[model samples]
Target: MLALSQGASRSAISRSNKARPDYRGSAFIADIHQNMSVTERGHFMQTKVMSTLNKKGVKAMGIRQVLPFKVLAADKYRAIRNNDSLFDLYGVLIGSCQYLTGIISARRQDELVSLKSSGNLSPNLNPFEHENIEYNLIFKLKKSGNGGKISSNKIIERPIAASIAKIIWRLEAFNEAARSQGLVKGKTLDLFNNLDARMCTLTKTSVKSFNAHLDSICDYFETPLVKMSNGELRRQYLRQHQLRRFFALLFFWQKRFQGLEALRWMLGHTDMSHLYHYISSNEVGDILNGVKATVIVQGVLNKDGELEKLKSIGELKATLAKKYNAGAVIIDDLESVIDLADDDDITAPHIDQLKAEANLESNLEELLKTGEISLEPNFFKVTDENGQVRETFNLAFQVKTV
Candidate 1:
């Protein structure tokens, strides 16, 4: 089944995105059950599986059953996924480097939509540098967290580092396109000085225009992006707000820091309740599974007698859960999942390639003068007082190559 929404593209949600649409949002979930009946392969079968929902009637996370198959066959799926550029931001284009980086985040579109100048992110300069590294994608925000009632600016981690460079790259790409249109510009970085009403990008993409692309996405998945039910509408709202990214980030930090304090600090939420909606018991099993894997891989095989490092799997799960107190990970729940996951030995990837030596090359001073990048010489090892001879980068501009 193919579940989707109408007038609810990621860019379509109002300036104040009301929902968090992810791969698991209601419309997409519903479409999976209520698939394209009139396909070339004869009519389809669908079961209107529904679940209990919140007061405002958001889509319930619990669907009856999910069965995914090749809707277009392997070849067709590949065709769509590969040549998605024609569909641009509608089809697999959502996975494009530009779309992903331009909207570097799903939750903070509003804050990015408000960027008026480059001054918000001052340059980090170094006279002699051998690396391109930036600490953060600093930006001024109106009620940071893209209007979570936050009073100050925000600095969140990038998707996979090089976020600043990627942003500059996209900005340059947009400028190159805009320049061809005779839209008037000295430099796009200099011209995109303000976020106008209904706009979502420095390139001036408006919400009204952005929502129009919803049809293409539905058409590709052979589904309709309409709010026929409260669950459907709620899911649409969530997707617009990019709640998936918000909750995903929270959950990611939850796994990393394994604590509520880390979550509160990163999100800047007033208290724990501000994020209760994103919390759930489903993750308890995930936490346990992770610990279970660690037990089998590291605890059991690494060193059976190192009590401090090799803890009983149960204790490991408990400690991780207690630290990340966002969800309840009772032993009973974990036990049920334990029986299902077949644990076995796994291999660690050989870092033979990582051990290979490589050279660094870039016009550091040129990039600096143009404010096109940042430099962090401290990230690499210099053979001498002169910044040369480095195998890899290790700094905040997030270069973890080695």
Candidate 2:
């Protein structure tokens, strides 16, 4: 069990980062980290999404239970056979979460923007993008979302996209159930009349009333279902958004095993300082247990492991040589290979892109395949001519080349 620092207290944080939406593609893995400050199990979060401090200043304590990812996956599979409203609702939630994480309201816009700029975002395909599946899906979801009157300006922070998508998708299922019960009569403000607008508006309603609505669906749609009062219904169902956030924090820990720097990149943050709340001492125990080590002579010590702009290919090659502990570096171009020595300089503006690929197209096969990267603050110590400690850096942050 991991732990969160004192920063997890609600008094310190103004908003809760409790939602994980699936926005798969270039949004990729860190999409889970977007706007979410995930913490270990011990982290304190408010029970209610919006709550004022009590008389003694104690926020109600309740860790909202969530359907585990595996369970959701199974529910989705079952939905195909059952075609039940509950099952359908579960399926939409799970399906929409495959690549989304942060705020439910903003996901459609991200997809919309990404779709409009796919050419710029992904020109050379990644291993998973053999035929532009992500590009196509973004366009499709954008079209579906536009049909619902979603606004570009209405954005939310750190709530799970899946939960929101579930709510959006669940309404259709609810309306269908109500129709079956002949309850979709006039003047009820049909929740589906303007789906996106209703979605934004519905968040302002009481969770108990919203839950009662779900119970009404259960009574209307399922054949042998039990009914409950509003309070009973609200208490029975876990606070859905909190559960979504719990899944996200778990994802944050899971990704930490893949190297913190990589996780930071995927989240699209300029720096990784914000994620510090999730780290406890030695959380990334022993990453380079079996990696070969050699004397490094020429790499820049990157404390943050951020890809910084280098002046020339000569500088990049020097960094790579020291990082890999090799005298010479080679670039495999299929038909032929180019050898880059420490002193090799480049005049071509395009060729300088080797700096970018240094981190992306790196020799991290072992960690990438295993997802067990260790985070060490001081990877190696640098010595001057007199054997005095000059600089201390971590091996996990070493820059690499293609």
Candidate 3:
């Protein structure tokens, strides 16, 4: 019986080896029926084993509890759809946020949305506050556009013409007051104070008006002075000044009579031939020629006599040049004649005699009747060192009306 059992066991081992070569090498499987069961188990384990356990010589066997194939497929489809809709929805939200707050930025939008979601929205916020946020966002975008930095100078510059106009207007008021009321004691101070106060108020009103006017002008020109750089605004202002100067000159010359009908009659139109005669016969000529020469001579004497007289002439020439808008001219040389005179007795008594004759000139009323009341200054010219004659002219008048 022992011989028979040994034969059976050997026969089983031999049969297991023939069926599975790996089974013979392992002590775990011996009996043919147990081996057959183990063989079936190994086949199951091999099919279900994870890749990690296969490498370690250990076979895995258990139910994986995997999610349903349909559920996983549905989740994938939803993820892809969400991705497609996200960009468009984000764009809409960003646009709405920008419209409401007047600001544009992803980070700012995110912050705002976060705030809203967090229930931190404030009802006390005013339009200005909302505007500030918008302004800040715009500023950041502008900075980003310009490489994330802005110059300090560019940020601080503004229109200067309005300020300049206010200053000029104040000066004109002061001058007008001084001219209307003669140089009385303490009157200048009083006039200046009154004008200063009036001008201060006027300046504010004028500036506001000017700003509106400038806006209109800009609109007409299709330009914005406020948005323009400082240099550009300055150039525009200079051009404006040129235009104003031209118009002011025209108005000053045209309104000679200053609303006086009688004065207008006396100063006839340019077309009238008798105008020159009226001016030449006026008593104004006498007062001007008499006192003017004396004043000139005395003023020159107070400065160094001959040299001073030359200086005075030069100044007069400059004044004429400006008035006529002409190039400067050098008249006859006075140096030689001035040198011949004695320093101790430099007074020209003949000048006094000329003054007396000037005083006898006809009155304004008589000159007006004759149509000879010329109030405009005249021009003259003389040869220079190189025999080149130059001409300069002016039309300035200072008349004291009675």
Candidate 4:
């Protein structure tokens, strides 16, 4: 039945596209084909499916899911280490790598499984010797679709954060351990190879092993179950494809800071329209507006916020107050701003100006030069003469005292 529905959806898309070459409505249909509940697929042939699926798919994890998962995975890995359980440790390590790498690199499962020590997805230790990059995910094959043809295989390298690089290095060490145990021969062909089986590399069929490890970690962590649209609750399993959407959503939100062109290149897309389509139906703008409101409101409340003195914060506040008939009381609170941020009527022209005025990379470079911020593995620490940490900031522009 699922196969028939998938074929029907494909046939429908082909016919619809032929009928109207300019029609792009079927862009999200593939996502729907995967996410539609068994009951929903009964009506899969209906005209409404296209419209509903346009903005719908299996939900991806937000920061809430990602952070806790990371912490839990770390704890589990540490626990397994004490028992000297090599196999269990390997599971946790590979699972964490796959999950985080999916989010960080936005690479498809095929590409991820193809990662090797000397092939695609190679690591660069002395990246700074050439570029300023300390670590990078170098890819030998990129799946860039141009007019439905795969682009030439080229050396595509993306700078990964230090924390992620540490894990990749750990995976290398795990490979060495596996070799010592006679699990494999020389240099491993795949970074995610199954150590228990000699010369066996992880393929698309082997994805469950990765997710099973992730599930164990999440269950151990006692993370909340996700409520599905069908009114059934289930654990939020980190799937391979959802990683791309998660990356697109977060990158779209941060595109004001990091250019869209950069994201386009990182995603291996030949067309900007394909990248835009990824977020068009995904409520990307809504999430970003809420994020902006939170930042601006927090800046207004916290005197020490990174964006506290920005002119746009004042303008946003004033605009919210006038547009929503919100008194000072309402605009001042984070929750109130969140409530107001969803409305399509509220628009802040000055918010556009904020993007031009604030360049995060430049600000960080300046701060580093002036010794106001010291880089850490996970975050930037600001300290005083006594060496007591004053404030901490992450890439998300969040400020907190430790």
lDDT of each: 0.32, 0.31, 0.29, 0.46
Give the count of colliding residue pairs in each prediction: 21, 18, 7, 0
Candidate 1 lDDT tens digits, 1-402: 011111111233222222223435554455443333322111111222112223232223222222222345555433443332221222223223223433344334454544433333324332124146553444443342223455445444433245544444444455444445443223443312222211222234334433333323433444423322222321121233343244443443343323444444444456655543223222222232232222232222234334234324345345434543624433333333333322412122112211110000112122222333222212234464585564333211211111
Q: Compared to the true structure, candidate 4 yields what TM-score?
A: 0.41
User: What is every candidate's alpha-carbon RMSD to the true fold?
Assistant: 20.8, 26.3, 39.7, 19.7
lDDT measured at residue 383 in model 1 versus the true structure, 0 to 100:
63
Per-residue alpha-carbon lDDT of model 2 for 1-402, expressed as tens digits? 011111222333323333433335454367444534333221232223223223232223221211112335655433432333322333333223322422222223233222221121212233232432222121222221324564344322222223333443344455444444433224343322211110111121233433333333333343231122221211122233433333333433343333445434433335546443222211111112112110111122232323233333244445445556663332222002113322334322223233323332343323322332222344345666898774334324343332
Per-candidate TM equals: 0.31, 0.22, 0.15, 0.41
Model 1 global lDDT (CA atoms, 0 to 1): 0.32
Candidate 4 residues 1-402, lDDT tens each?
122223233332223333222225564455444433223322332323333332222122111111012344656533543422323444555676777877887776656666664323234453333344467786555453435565446667776776667677666565555445444534444666543311122222246655665655554344555433343555545676666656655643453423456676775567667754542323333233333333444455577766666554455445445534563333345434434444524343223222322332233233333334322212344666898774333433322111
Better of 1 and 4 by lDDT: 4
**Over 4 Å off, model 2:** 1-132, 135-235, 238-240, 252-267, 274-402
lDDT of 1 at 121: 33
> Residue-wise lDDT of candidate 3 within 1-402, one digit each (tens)?
111111222322224333444553764455643434233223222232223233322223221211112224555323322332221222233222222332111122122222211111122223233433211211111111225353322211111123222332343344344434432223222111111110111111122332333332333233322212221221122122223223323322344333222222323334323543433444322333333333433443355655354533565434434533553221211222234333424243233222322332222223323333223434456676999775533443322221
Best by lDDT: 4
The candidate with the higher lDDT, 1 or 3, is 1
